[model samples]
Target chain A: MNTLFVKAPAITLRFVLLLLISTVAMVADHRYRVLEMPRGWLLTVMQPIQFVADWPAQRWHGWTEVVAARSHLLQENKALLEINQQLATEHQQFAKLQAENRRLNELLQSIATSSLPTRYRLARIVQVSLDPHTLQVQINLGSQADVFLGQPVISSAGVFGQVVHLSRYSAQVLLITDSSHALPVIDQRSGQRAIARGDGPSGLLRLPFLAAHADIREGDLLLSSGLGKVFPAGYPVATVRSVSTPVGEKFAEVVAVPVADPGKVQEVLLLWPDRAVQTIEEPVTDDLVDDQADDGDHE
Target chain B: MNDVANWRDGWLILTTLLAALIIDSMVLPQFLGSFRPDVLAVIVIYWSLMAPQRVGVGVAWVAGLLVDVSSSGLIGLHAMVLSMQAYITLMLYQQIRMLPRFQQTLFVLILMVLGKLLAMAVLGMTGRLPTIEFWFSLPASVVFWPLIYALVQRWRKRALLPS
Candidate 1:
């Protein structure tokens, strides 16, 4: 059993060599495109593993479908139809507002009219990264359907995350609740601007620089300010959950729960909105274009 | 089974590792996310001890690489961590095997936590401070070691050997 290769020091040698290689790879990945090709291929190769991993969950989901009662499906259908009817009712008023806004833009001959018509596609969550530190999810849509890096992804209810990486058949979205993620948000109640950063997957956002006496309150809705030009403006990002100021602390430790539950989103909305939402083309613009000021997000 | 001289168990190990990878990446209910076992880590630990020559540092490195890729994480991140884990297991296999089952579990708890902390350190150095869920995974994985050990043993008896 005592092979020469199995000598005690051999294990140390292998471990050190492999660790050195891995560390170099990680640093290279973080700093440059040095490893993108290999990384992409590895993910592609591992696709089947992920697919097979998904099989049990997918099968379990199918089982639920098989046992679903006819009455239950019927009830679900009816409820969905009713919701559609309500949305359609809201659509009529939105089209009128859109026309009026167009007219106003024409009269003013402003850059707001330069905003391009936007389109969006639906994608399903295929995999969720199990790493507790990095909050990311893999969606079924990829470069095939015009998915791009930095494109904004939203749930039907509100803004969720941004697409970070894309393969041919899948993409990864970094959730706003990740610690490294920061977003520009405006409080709907007071129109106060603050930068909301994720504290981690407790599903809450922290406003780091807001003054202790800022006119913010619990239950205030925070919307994308669009200052970052990544997430479109006026989508609900989070709702204020708490506000606190420790003794002598300069900024209020304002806490908020994300309006879009990263875990609960079955399908994501990939938006193709223009860079500025209005793209005033002004270098120093602070306000998100007010052309869609009503901000109902009809589409 | 004991009398059999055959050592052709490659397929059995591969299937278990594949299953482990799948289970690790599968999406679970939100409440269960915290309790999600590090299936791949546990499996690597089990195999490096059960059959060190077959599934040593190199096998563990590949397993870690697969996890990093499949999870869509930074490349080589898990490869380094899992390789370290397997190395430690190899170093202590003899002593660990001699311990009682409960003590074996206790040792596993320490090893799992240490590996997790090392991975966490790598993330922190890369400027990503993971959520509490990441921190919670150590305990979660430690709790799953006995199950992994038993499963590997069962596979050994049921598939690897002929009765």
Candidate 2:
């Protein structure tokens, strides 16, 4: 036991050394963007362990999905078919409207061309944070593909989150449902606008600053007003679940549910629109010149 | 070296950790998730209490680091809190062993809460404090403590039985 005392200090020293090493790693990581290489290396080494860690849960989820009652599956299938039919009809109308909008845009382009460079790519969700407190998701795309920091992330439903950290082959998305995340949104129906913030795993969103008499109601859809320019206009954000106006409180307490179901989404599209069309005269391809020559010959 | 070949004991601990990680990640029943037990924490605490010579602050630190990496948070935060918890548990092992099962569980439950609170405090100071989910998970951990204690105890007893 007396000898154990001497070994104890040695163990503590070693432990402190490990702590110092990790702290230095973290600090260096934060201080310089150049540290990204080592961080990527660490993530690559850790990827296998992460896969092992997630295997059981993912397998169980797969099993449950398989064992679900046939009747329930049929019911879900029917519901999906109905929803698909409705969407198909809406999509046709949307296509026509889009064509008209494109024509109008072309006419406007004759006058001026706005040159805001934006681009996007599709990525898959590789993992989600287990701790409900931190609503974050990891995507498989990273700096290798030019995914910059602070890029807005969205889903089919609406704005999901923004890219906070980037690595070589992966990036961490800060979900809008995260406590630290907030977005500017406006009610699509009433045109009243307010800031929407996450209320944590209760899966609720709150619009904290609305006048007591604001014409908002349950089921009102909130959309991105594009005021911040981070989010594109008219993306569905949330639906008002409840509105509370307590006497003497200046702001009405508005609770909303996010349009995107964070748990189930597998893939997301990252949009990066072209800023300008740079004309580069490549040595004209033989095939292109031949086609043009053929056209001239026919004329 | 022969004792290290105790597959039954090693496998049980591995399975328990796997299950806990799964439950922590997945969308389980609302009540269960809300009061979800800290499986890894309980396992580390139990091992440190029962076999202080084998499991120590280092093992706890590694486990906590894994949890931190698995979750999206500051890297060292969980590792630091877990080492602190293991240290306290090791110091109090003798007194804990003497207590009744229920009393021991309660003592450990307090330790788990302390660990969680400490982690939250570290996160808060770092400006990474989580929202309401942080507060909700603490009480939920306490509520699930008894079942976790019983499950670990049963496994320990089963492993100790000479085959």
DockQ of 1: 0.60
| Candidate 1 lDDT by residue in tens digits, A1-299 | 43423456988898899989998888786654356456656767777877776777778878999899999999999999999999999988987887888999989987535343277889988854545557788888876776766678899989898876666667777788876577899999999999888776577889988988899999999998877777777899999998989998998889999988876777899887765345535321222122233221111
List model 1 lDDT by residue over B1-163, tens digit each: 4224224467767888888887888877778877777888888888778777778889989889878866768778889888988899899888888999899888878878888788878787766756676666667787788877786677667764456
How does model 2 score on DockQ? 0.20
Model 2: clashing residue pairs? A117-A275, A118-A272, A118-A273, A119-A271, A119-A272, A119-A273, A120-A270, A120-A271, A120-A272
DockQ for all models: 0.60, 0.20
**Which residue runs of candidate 1 sit more than 4 Å off their true CA positions?**
A1-11, A30-37, A106-109, A112-117, A127-129, A187-191, A211-220, A241-253, A274-299, B1-7, B91-110, B126-163
Q: List, residue by residue over A99-139, the lDDT tens digit for candidate 2.
A: 77778879887532322335657888874345455677877
Candidate 2 C-alpha error for residue A250, in Å: 5.7
